[model samples]
Each structure stands twice: as structure tokens, then as C-alpha cells.
Target: GGAKYLFPGIAGPDIINFTHWLGALVTSMHTIGVKDTPTRRVIHRAADFLPIPLLCIAMVLKGHDLHGLYIGPHSEAFSAAADLSAQLNIITVDRPFNHVLSMPSTMYDDLWTAAKAMYKTEPAIADGGEVIIFAPHITEVSYTHGRLIDQVGYHVKDYFLKQWDRFKDIPGSILAHSTHVKGSGTYDLATNTETPRIQVTLATSIPAERCRRINLGYLDYRDINPQTWQGREQEGILVVPHAGEILYRAKNLSNTATKGPHRSISGGASTS
Candidate 1:
């Protein structure tokens, strides 16, 4: 007298990618009012590289109740394909699943190195000055706000100008963009040997003109090395060995878009 069809929703790509034939047999069992469906596997580690394959293998190894699987933000396998397939089913589904990564190792190491290097030199951003950080956009996509802070480091905050005022400030006061600057180096020209001048070169993914247009500097990635930092001229420059690993937060000049002072993982890539 009520509804003729009994539908169940699958959360994450796990159901679509791992389950065979929509687990139709199990769903059918539930449709007939079967009260109990066994769970084949329970996934706890959402951070693993590919969690869906693991879920699929477990489901096939020891059948499960298609209706019993519960999914949430922690289920990391959600994707476009999974979402599309869900449209075909009329069942009331569970809410979507998602999660966040703590931080990439490359970023941690780079930040630590930069912090130590800058301690003696102490790079500063004056009251009206700015410090720009350029990286591939994909790099920012991989970081959460908290992880970004770890990559940016706490000590750097001491250098921010307290009375800063600007119409437009990059996120966190640091610009994270698609441009790439891997390394930098300096060349010396000893003309007449009086006061030798140094010429610096930057290796990057984009051309020098683009960097100039955006008011950012450039350096070739390969030019920088261990010995380069030892030079006196290099003292003030903070080198981030790997942009993909580091996440940075720039200081905000305005209060309207102020984030939490605690510096939590406020933003990052979203999981389906």
C-alpha cells in the first residue's frame, strides 16, 4: 500500500567501486524485510592511499549486508563516478563521507630547515612591505589549514607587521599560486676586483615576465644547493625545498575575513 521498491544508498566510492553488481542479492534480501545483513569489513584508516580497493576485496571475500554499511566524512573513496551511480538508485542513502590528511612529510622538513636557517638572519616584512610565496596550485590543493600553518611555521609570525593595512592581502598574507620556483642561486662578477657584484638567477616553471607582472621574484629550482645557503648573501632568503609539501598561512590585514586565531585546519581540498 505504501512504497513498492526498497532502495538503499551507498556512501563513498566503496559501494560502487568495491561491491559487485550493486550487491543486488543482498539488497533484494533486505527488500523482503530481511532484518540482518552481515558486515564483511570495517574500514578504520581513511588516510590510506587507496581505501576503496581494500573495501571491495573485503566485501567480496566475505559477503556483507548491502544495507548495513554506514559511511561518513571519514570514508575517503568518494568520487564523481560514485556520485553519478547513486543517482540511479531511489533508496534513501546515508550522508557522504570525507576526511583530512595531517600533513605531508616534505612540507615538515622544508619548514624546519627554513626556520633554522632564518633564525640568525631573521627575515622581516616591514610595515608596508610584503613577502610573496609562490607555488604550484596543486600544492595548496593538497593541504589543510592546520597543515598549512605547520608548513608556514610559527616563528615567521613574529615578523608580520602589527599595523598592516592593505586593500587586498593574499590569503594568510602569503600568496599560494600555480607558479613554480624551485631554487635560486647567485653569480659573481669581479670587474676590476673592487666590489664584486652578484647576479642572482631563479629557476621556475613559468617565465620571468609572468613573475614580474605579478610583482613576484623568480629563481631556477636547480640553482639552489647546500653550499648556496652558506653564502652571506643568501642568509636572509628562506628556501622551501619542496613547495608541494609546505602549506603557508599569510597574515590577514582586515578583520572581516579573520580566521580562528588558534590556526586550525580551516581550509583544504574537499573529498566527495
Candidate 2:
């Protein structure tokens, strides 16, 4: 119909949501410019793209499903947001350099402690080894997928190679992306067979299948606390909390004393 052609074209829910939000942003920008008839019409049209944001507001007003807390007052909302930020591995921390891994959660501490107890601690991770950072589905999307690298203040050597080839090529280090799977296993994808690996699980709810498929070595979130690192483990694997936010490097931390001023290591990785 002719009426359909008068407005933006939307394919589905996802597209509509993004377009609507974007439209709102564009409309906001329009407020700073001239307000003509066509501009007004565009602004009016963009106003309709508020379903998702409205839904989010409603959810927050009622209380988040994950925690079931309705922050009524503005101050309370700010407090809640701060607490939420910390939980998401985003927060303001004022501290000096230190060797101890100030892990965010008990789950992370247990896992790292166990791995350290089991594995032969390496003087420098760059000597040779792999680190597999894993998290739950939500965390994977929010933090682990790729955002965690920025929060940790490390630059990817080759952005194009990593994006196109799916390999994080940090110098003297084998950084691997974690995949969500039903079972557990490690796959040797490299030509060389002597790469060390670390498996860090971020509070996953998957069954312990052990490293069966891809042999990067395996560490289960469940296996921590209850069980210490089994016998003698190979390499060093650490499952950090807020996997998207924290990428621990021995050299970086060990040399933090000589480094520049510290910055707060918190915030969500921008998907953009």
C-alpha cells in the first residue's frame, strides 16, 4: 500500500528495535537543528520507535527478573546501577600494583587457586601457552565474545587477522576464544603441537564432560571449590570472573609498579 511506503522499512523484531532506537537518537539530534515540517514529521515518526525502550523501563520499574529488586528512588537506582556494574565486572577500584589476582567472585578465586595449585607456575606466560576464557551464554555475548580485551587495556596485534581468521595473535601468546558447547573437549588447530593452554570457565552451568573434543585443556566452573586441581596439571589455565572485562597478563601486572597511572577497569565492552 502507499501508506506503507511513507515510513521506514522494517523486516522483523530485531531490525525494528534497532531502527526505532536509532530513530530516537536521530530525532534527538534533530532537536539541535532547524525544526521544519519534514523534520517534525520525521521526529513524529521516530517517536513511535519506543516499544523496546518502554519495555525496558517497565521491567526496571517492576524489578529486574534476575534479582527482583525495584529501585524506587533516583538515589536507590544509582546505587543499584553501581552494584550491578560491579557484578558485571565493571567498577571503580582504587589500588596500587600487586601480584595477587584480586579475583571478583568466589567462583573465579576457587578456579584460579586450584589451577595454580595443580599447574607448574610459569615465570612468564609468553614463554608458551594458551588461555581459553569462557562464560555463560549471556556473559559470552556481553563480555567474553570480544569486549573483555579492551577493559583489560590490551591491544590486539592484528584486528583484521583476528576478525577474519578468528585467532587472537598476541605476541608470544596463544589467545583462544571460548565456544559454548554441550560437552567438553580440546581441539589442536595449530600446526605446532607444543602450545600451552588455560581454560577459565565463568560460572557456566554445563555438565563436566572433561576435555574430550578440542584439546586446549578443560576447567569446569563446577569443578572448582569442591575439587582442587587434579594431580599434576599442564600449563596454566585461569577462568576469570567477568571474562569479558579481565585479561590477566603476568608481564603487565608484574611491571605495573613502573607503569603509568591506573585506570578503573570496569564497564561493558561496546559491541560497536
Candidate 3:
């Protein structure tokens, strides 16, 4: 919970499972007794918070019935989930500067590939009763959703407005306060908030917090005809399913948006 970012709240053998630092903490305790009880009590405090953390994991994951793995820039949520491992279907990944969609597209592909390889769960089954809902932070999606602004779907501007409102309501949001487990990289509610309209660092430059709103809007407004949440096409059914679903979806969507606008001249004639 402190600088280590591991589950220090939990005491006993469980702490050993937290991180390398925790194993050391336990080792230290065995070899040398510390004066402060806070050091020892952290593990139990974590143990006590188990049920609440589990409830949170359930709520965050309830959007999709499948295995919900939260790839975070930090591991607070996962550590919290670790306590109630029996009740939760979740995994966490923490990489510095890796706040959701900030990573490259290749990284996302690699991540999905690795996850698929490891879990080996069919996209249909892993998706639970409904589609799998994988919600990343959405930084890049904000800048890119504008290209799809005029397409036959919701306007990017209006989409962002709704997204801002909804983000305040998500499970672990400060406004919602509904989740027992806390989200990592949260900003202080009192300060460090700014509107893109107010403080102009650059054209359309918004703070990370507000930027999140735009990204959320992108997700809400996307033309999913070409994309997969967990996996597969929503409109097209595959002969073999999942394996060819993405390619199948690509065929149905307007390729112009993905590749580039068509470049045929009005007076073009066949020239040898």
C-alpha cells in the first residue's frame, strides 16, 4: 500500500504471494522483529479488506461475464483482488507510463496475443453471456476518434460530453465511491483538475483527466462493425468463428476509414 505498491495490508503467509518485496518483508520479520506494529499489522489489515476488494472486482468485471484482466499502470487493484482470489476473475498488469491506450498498437496486439495464448479460452466462452468489455484508459482513442467524427455514427464532440459524465460514475470513481478496491493513478479530487476549454496549453490539448473523457467518448461512439471487444464480429457470424471473425468484420466495414480515402480521379480512363 505504501511505496512498494504491493499488498502490505495483508499479513501472514499471504503477503509472501504479494511481491518480491513482500517475501523480503516476511523474511525480515522472521530474522528480526521490528519495533513498529504498523509494519506487522499491514498484512492483517489487507486480510480484513478482502471481502470489499472482491465485491469491487465483481462489479468492474460484471460488464462482461468472462475473465476480466485489468491492465493498469499500477497493481493496486490486482493486489486487492489477490486477497479474495476465490471470488474474482481478474488479472492486473502494471508498467510505467502504460496508462491504458498510451501504449502502441503493436503492444496491444501483443498483449491480446499473449493473453489468448495463456488463457486459451475461446472468445465466445470467455465473453460470458454477452460480449467481452475491455475498457482501456483511451488516450490515443481521443485523438483518433476525430477522424471518424463525420462518419455515420455519433458526433465525436457529443460523444465526449457523455463520456465525461459517465467516467465520474464508473465503479471506483471518486464520485461513485462504490468499489471497495481502489483504482490506481487517481488524481486528487480537490485540485489538479483543469478543463481544455479554460487552460489552453495547445489546440485541443486537455488534461489527462479530461482527456479520459474524450477517450471514453471514442469507445462509446466507435463503429464496432470492424472491431472486437473481447473478440469476433457482432453482425457477421463466422464459419469457424473467432479465428476468422476480425478479418470477416473488416470486409463488411468501409475500408476507406482504416486504410485511407479513395483516390480515383473524375476523368480517369484506362491508360496502357
**Best-fitting candidate, scored by lDDT:** 2
Worst 10 residues of 2 by lDDT: 263-272
Q: What tens digits encode model 2's per-residue C-alpha lDDT throughout 146-234?
A: 34322221212222123435443331111212211101122333432221222222233322332322222334433333223222123
Root-mean-square deviation of each candidate, in angstroms? Answer: 22.3, 16.1, 19.0
Winner by TM-score between candidate 2 and candidate 1: 2
User: Candidate 1 deviates by what RMSD?
Assistant: 22.3
Candidate 1 has its poorest 10 consecutive residues by lDDT at 1-10
Identify the superior model by TM-score, candidate 1 or candidate 3: 1
Q: How many residue pairs collide in each prediction?
A: 13, 13, 7
Q: How does candidate 1 score on lDDT? A: 0.23
The true-versus-predicted C-alpha distance at residue 158 of model 1, in Å, is 25
What's the true lDDT of residue 79 in model 3?
A: 45
Per-residue accuracy of model 3 over 1-272 as CA lDDT, tens digit each:
22123353333333543332332223221211122234335544554554544322221232235444443322354444333432442222121110011111223232122112111111111111111112232223223233332221211122222345644332111111110001011222356331111000001112334333322111221222222222322422212212211111111211110111221111121110
Q: Cα deviation in Å at residue 10, candidate 2? A: 16
The CA lDDT at 225 in model 2 is 39
Poorly placed runs, candidate 1 (over 4 Å): 1-202, 219-226, 230-237, 248-272
Clashing pairs in 3: 9-42, 9-43, 9-46, 10-43, 10-46, 11-43, 11-44
Tens digit of per-residue lDDT, candidate 1, span 214-263: 32334433333433333232222333333222222123212121111121
